[model samples]
Target: MDSVPLFALNDCDVMTTNGSKLGTLENITLNPNTGELKFLCVNPSSEESTEFPQMENGQVVVPVDSVETTREYLIVTAP
Candidate 1:
């Protein structure tokens, strides 16, 4: 997989493969030693914010593997 700078993805909208809007990318979790992306912190849309389980510190930590990037949005698959 190609690596992208976290700054380039900040504030990007997040959506599902089905085209459902989930939220916006707020932050990222990285491995200190490897610099690998670990989690994507998302600020969820009001409608679905409460639907996700695993949210922490006001942001949802989405697994990097579930994300598919595009010019306009970060598409994520539900695990």
Candidate 2:
């Protein structure tokens, strides 16, 4: 983490390539001063893995540079 101000997006919609609602951005991890994003986690309504058992439905890391652009929200390419 570079200690940059974390990108704060509220109720920002997130979707997979296939257009699946992957929840919203829990929060963005970035290198503060450097302004480099590191990883992001999903803020699922439920943290219970067994409740929503899906390998894909979970916190996944997004590459720093993969972010195309961030406006009201961020558009990150799925890895």
Candidate 3:
């Protein structure tokens, strides 16, 4: 797995590598034992959200491996 840079979750916007907006960073899931990040919880934007991954319980769980953080946004790749 590639090393994903640590980022401030609240400071970034979540989008796809293809440039589709998924939403804002809302929460993160972690592995309790290792304290490693597991997934990113995103709150989908009101419009064009259907283009994003299907939401479960009002949020999407983006796998950490698919995320790449830039200075401005969190780019998510397709699973």
Candidate 2 global TM-score: 0.50
Q: 33 in model 1: Cα distance from truth in Å?
A: 1.3
Runs in model 1 deviating more than 4 A are 47-52
lDDT of 1 by residue, 9-79 (tens): 87999887788888888888889999888887888876445344546467777888888888778988887
Candidate 2, position 28, lDDT: 66
What are the lDDT scores of the predictions, listed in order?
A: 0.78, 0.52, 0.74
Off by over 4 Å in 3: 1-7, 47-56
lDDT of 2: 0.52
Candidate 3 lDDT = 0.74
- Model 2 ranges off by over 4 Å: 1-8, 44-58, 68-76
Candidate achieving the largest lDDT: 1
TM-score of each: 0.82, 0.50, 0.77
lDDT of 1: 0.78
**lDDT tens readout by residue for model 3, 1-79:** 2454455557468988778788888888899999988888888865444433555577777888888877678888876
